[model samples]
Target: MITKDVRNWLGALTFLISLCLSGCQSGNAPASSPIETNRSLAPQRVDIRGSILSSQYSDGQVILEVERLSPSPDSRYDRAYVLVLPTAQMVDSEGLSVSISELRPGQNVAILLRAGGQGNRTGIGVARKLWIEDRF
Candidate 1:
């Protein structure tokens, strides 16, 4: 049998424990990991060739949605990026840092776009060479 004061103290203690546990869980919130996907070949062996329909920057990389317009009788879309490898983070050539604006639209370029996740987006990217892979 606990007194009223003792009961209140227990309740407070319980509440504090719960709050601590919740804080730990919330703190460990997972970040966006590009490597955690079925497609592991991303950023390692990505050799894509496509025509840039449009390019934009997101999260740090160049989000380029291109059109594989030639090889096929009908064109298909392939999304890619230009990012830093190994770290799976977006960075520019020269191993520095870059943005989507660098890869301007209306520009024909072929990049090593890492095979993305379920969204068909690439992981990291490398602007190996631009305006070189002329399928014309």
Candidate 2:
């Protein structure tokens, strides 16, 4: 027969296992593929000084240039990377290549990030946000 402590430990182990298994779903899709969907997304545009774009942000974030801008059925915009100023950094430790649809060229891709969805001023979308400006 198992003690009460053993039962609690088993429960915690089960919970952690379940969480780990759920995370594996993202592994099926490679990082470079375009996200094709019809999900509704409203993207807000912002223009920042190109000279200051890289200096203001913390590490793990970068000011990438928009290489291409495509319209997806899901998000209002699909940006691809043409060039990245400073260096190309990974998001959330996922060293996966930043996709072509995730940026565009000639324009500063990201300088100020928005939390969650790119609107909040105080929140930094450091782990999961891409900043981009389309207008010159």
Number of the top TM-score candidate: 1
Q: Write the per-residue lDDT of candidate 1 for residues 87-117, one digit (tens) a residue.
A: 3333432334443455665554445433432
State residue 6's C-alpha deviation in candidate 1, in Å.
Answer: 99
lDDT of 2 at 92: 15
lDDT (CA) per prediction: 0.47, 0.36
RMSD of 1: 12.5
Estimate, for each residue in 44-95, the C-alpha lDDT of model 2 and write its tens digit: 4322222122222335334342322343232322332122333434221122
How well does each candidate superpose onto the true structure, as a TM-score?
0.33, 0.22
Rate residue 98 of model 1 by lDDT.
42
Candidate 1 residue spans exceeding 4 A from truth = 1-46, 72-100, 115-135
**TM-score, model 2 to reference:** 0.22
